[model samples]
Target: MNVTDPKANLAALIKCPSVTPAEGGALGALTEMLSPLGFKVERSTETDENTPDIENLYARLGGEGPHLMFAGHTDVVPVGDEAAWTHPPFAAEIADGQMYGRGAVDMKGGIACFVAAAARYIEKHGKLPGSLSFLITGDEEADAVNGTIKLLERMAKAGETWDACLVGEPTNPDKLGEMIKIGRRGSISGWITVFGTQGHAAYPHLADNPLRGAVQLANALMEVPFDQGTDEFPPTNLEVTSIDTGNAATNVIPAAAKVVFNIRFNDLWTADSVKQEIITRLDKAARTGNLRGERPPVRYEIAWSIRPSHVFLTRDDKLISSLAGAVESVVGERPKLSTTGGTSDARFIKDYCPVVEFGLVGQTMHMVDERVALADLETLTQIYETFIERWFADART
Candidate 1:
């Protein structure tokens, strides 16, 4: 089987506007495509009181040991200003050898290529050498409250596990095979609030001036470096994203000040350690700062958002070597194993099993007229097919 042509499959997927939290029939289309290949496809919908019900799919073809899973999401980010595009965002039009659509590069393209690759592998070998499965979700781009995390729980409850997993997120920055994400930097967000007395600006002796305390606190946090980084990750960084006092008048000092900051940390620190460091620095600053008699010294409260993502590295030799070999075979160059990106669903999947991300060049993902080269899609399909073959052939079971 020719795998039903990856380009055609991608075009069909692009036509479905399955934005975050909405299925848009994309999973249905996938199920239809996989069912004919002797795959046992299961569609699961997870519901939460706070989030919309999301539809996910897990499909498998072989059932023995050494299971290899391909993980991805079908949901595309919102298309901003549809009229601004040269072609419709959902048209999936192929012009000048490029497929233009919202998710052509970000993700849908990867799913299409994998499906075609799997079909071709089965056609050539009559059956996969080992188990093959796909874990797809529809809530990766939004709050993520009801997406892959829920699906993984369901899978675990059902006694499912994998030897290794590949996340088909768009990882390449410039070229098709320049980078493969082997790890990701950890992320943490914090909100700091400082309390003081409010008074008229004219009466300097009466006003406590919370802004002054906030400024001092911000300086203390920014003055020192978080860490020098490790061999696998870059140095940690903290940046104040916003500062708010809610004061509108020029003459009145605000009673409180708030600063919002985020840190993209490395392997050198954990969320608790980072928080403790911040508190220590702020306390030191507060002790040294001066304030009017009517107002007490600077007092602050710090709150953290969701739990921070712990830095993770994938060192599994077999998974890395096989995927890298396949990439080199198809792209003519060994891809760089990098950990220099933001975050992805892999942050959640890493807890379950070792995971690596590789896919098409992502130079235009989440940008206007987002698209992928038709030739690149074909090449990626070949790479996935090759990787699947080699990975299973090398399996012990």
Candidate 2:
């Protein structure tokens, strides 16, 4: 409940090994931390027969116009080989003034700073001028099926709405206040299988090899660039992740060849358009070389898993300007508004309210020896406190 020192709060949070779909007592810890601050906490467990049940928390304080929400995940990615780390990944060790842990930088640090900021704000202002709430989930690092998305649905069903939201994802690339995420690129993945006849490799004329067709398809997919750099985003990209024929013997040709690929695209193309383009290119490649008959070179089937994420840009002047002002006030520089990054939970939160990502520098996130600087922990807490005050102050209009 001591909000003065964010580093201490973060140290406590990073000690919890709350990996994906596992509570690991992280939410319980957070509940205890927030409850004493006058927040009414509610826990919801979402279960799917396919995915492990996830426990989430929704806590709020104050009741008035201009409700502001802070959204983040407590779950962390696996620590991989524990022996590879100098300090235990979940030990929350502080060495050279840096806190080392899996979720130390990628998130838990942000949550701690915000909570500390809220506590400090309450101490100074007596009570928040506007409503404040937290939407915390445990599935951000995993499939995200039973996390914020489900919670938002439930909130809607219960007639709850927010004016704005902030996701505590690490957005700074090199240093605190260097960058804030305003949008994110969409992602789509697919598997392409080119079918052919299986036969002895010794007799080339007798067998139809699918590998040749697959190579051609891959070449075609990568030959043309998806787009030139746009004004707001970089060029779209597609990469072949894997290619397999499952043929163990050199003398035998497999019946089918498969290639898996992923595309990180900008707003220029939609999921439907990208899939159509792949199909068009593959169709052209399939007609290239003839086998034994006068028909097409190979028969093929393309299966696409297009999980579309609509590109969102938050240009809300009040939301952007107030947060930017706060960052300037605390860190002495206004952060750049960027859309460059892999997708995040903000992708889902954007649908409900105008959301931006601002937190610690992420250069160490998801890497070996993930850590956060002790100084940064305090500075981030100051930034969040300033933003909270400015956001509520501006909402009065």
Candidate 3:
């Protein structure tokens, strides 16, 4: 069978419509593409109570020492208004020099480039000296309930392991060789509801306004600095995403106010420590009563999101240096080592092996008509191919 072109592979994937939680034929397409490259592919459908069933792919071309795994997601977020796109979101149309689609860069493009590079390597040099595999998931853009985490757990149960991992997340900010993510900050979300009493605006003595307590609590949460900038990461930051009283009438004082906030914290604090700090802030804020200081003590309930993303850093010389060298050789620029992005599946893969992220420029990811330059696909593939050679060579040493 003729090897599929990387751009073609990406176009095929884009056509799958595998919008998060929807299989959209992305994995099936990948299995078909990898099978021709001598990969032994196995598809697993993972499930949880609330989220939809997700199909994940794990393919290996060889079973040997010092494996290199490429991880990425196939699921793409919904294209807000398809009609608004210059080209059809999933049409995979190539115009001028770019491929236009939803997951083109955020990262079906990454998966395609790596697969193409692996194909070229096998064609030119035969099977890898070690093992070459892919850990592709379909639940990344969603709640992540049945994606990499479950896939990793299942693999561990089945005695699967690897030496290093490179997550194909779009890490570059402005240009293709601008950044490589060496680590990521931890993330946690908190939801709080302050309880008060409902009454007419005229009866200030009878109704305790929850917004008054909420203001104090929010201020306390934002007033204190979580930490200064770490060596690899920036200072911890929090943002209030929402504040809702749900009150419709001008005269009505809602009995409750809900506030939601998320924190992206660095290694200086653990999730437990961060939670404690937040609780402490909330406690102090709760003691602060209404502006008039006449209402009873304010009451509120706090709940943290179930899943907490832990901060991680990778310092593996072989893994980091090889990828950096590859980027420098291909793009003619040394990539900056960074840990400044939001988060990726690398957070989970970090627990298993030393993992870092490098992919195409991410400026257009997740935006309308998300896209990648046609030349970028070829360049990224070359980078991956070079990285593969450097990785296996260094692995032997």
Candidate 4:
């Protein structure tokens, strides 16, 4: 197979239907592509107590210093309403100028392009000044417990290290070379359940409606701003995603109400600090019992999500310049260094090395008809190829 062609590489991958936690032949297809290019490929399956096993791939070409790691995932979100798509979700069918599929842009397309880029670089330049590695995971779209985090730990224990990393998550909003994610906001989620007495709604003072306390607590979290905003990040924002009482009858007040919330915080606070702040706010509001009408402190219990992604920024000047310069060389403009967007596996990669992200436009990620333009695939391949050249040249000096 001609692994240097981005479209062919992507089509082979997209046909695999590798939904979260499933191998689905995606890694096998990747192995076939990389093996011919002289990469020593290895696949490892990660297992945990509660999480399903996940298969991850790590392949390297060359074993020298200043190694570059390209990180991404092959797992895709489920294809919703399969009948609604004009092209089959796993068919990799090209209509007009775009290829339609589940992981086309978020992002089996990125993986394909990077593979093609590395292939093209090797074909033209013989060998890199140092090394290049691919860290691909199959559990990114779902519970990440058995994916990159575990793979990174295992690899590090085997004495593997990287100088810098580029995560190929789709970063462009509308077009290629428009933005590169240099940092990401931290994220945390929690559920608050407020307790009360169950009684008939007709008796005004007979029952304490937990809904009132839930509303007050939810309001307290949203009413106050976490921070004005940071120089490198936006202000911390929290949203009350759900409020449930599970009460159906109009005449009855429920015994408990649950309020679920998630917050995306900026650099001004760490996960611990933000968590503390949330507890403080909830405690203060619970004490008032304003809507409880002089009742005892609102009875409530809080449970946080198991994993809290911490905020980070990449300050590696040479690494940043090499990628930005490549984008400019291909697309005729320097990409914006952005910190917007939800968390990605880059959050985990950051603990190991300085990491940044750039890839295809993200206009249709996870949508019913998720797809990628053929042109964007070719262009991204060129940009990745150029980035490889620039980074290795910079590292040599």
**TM-score of the candidate numbered 2?**
0.95
lDDT of each: 0.88, 0.86, 0.91, 0.95
Q: Model 4, 85-151: lDDT tens per residue? A: 9999999999999999999999999999999999999999997789999999999999799999999
Candidates 2 and 3: which is better by TM-score?
3
Question: Candidate 1: where is the Cα deviation over 4 Å?
Answer: 1-3, 248-251, 289-296
Q: After superposition, how far is residue 348 of candidate 4 from its true place, in Å?
A: 0.6
* Top-lDDT structure, candidate number: 4
Q: Model 3 segments beyond 4 Å from truth?
A: 1-4
Tens digits of per-residue lDDT for model 3, 1-397 = 3343679889989999999889899999899889988899989999989779999999998888789999999999999988889999999999989999999998999999999989988988986899988999998898898999999998889988899999999998988888999999999999999998899999977888889888888888998898897888899999888999988899988899999999999989999999999998888777764565756666999999999999999999999999999999998999999999798899899999999999999998889989999999999999999999999999999
RMSD of 3: 1.2
Which stretches in model 2 have alpha-carbon errors above 4 Å? 289-295
Q: Model 2, residue 167: displacement in angstroms?
A: 0.8
Reference-based TM-score of each model: 0.94, 0.95, 0.98, 0.99
Candidates ranked by lDDT = 4, 3, 1, 2
Which pairs clash in the backbone of model 3?
A: none
Whose TM-score is greatest here? 4
The local lDDT score (0 to 100) that residue 217 gets in candidate 1 is: 84
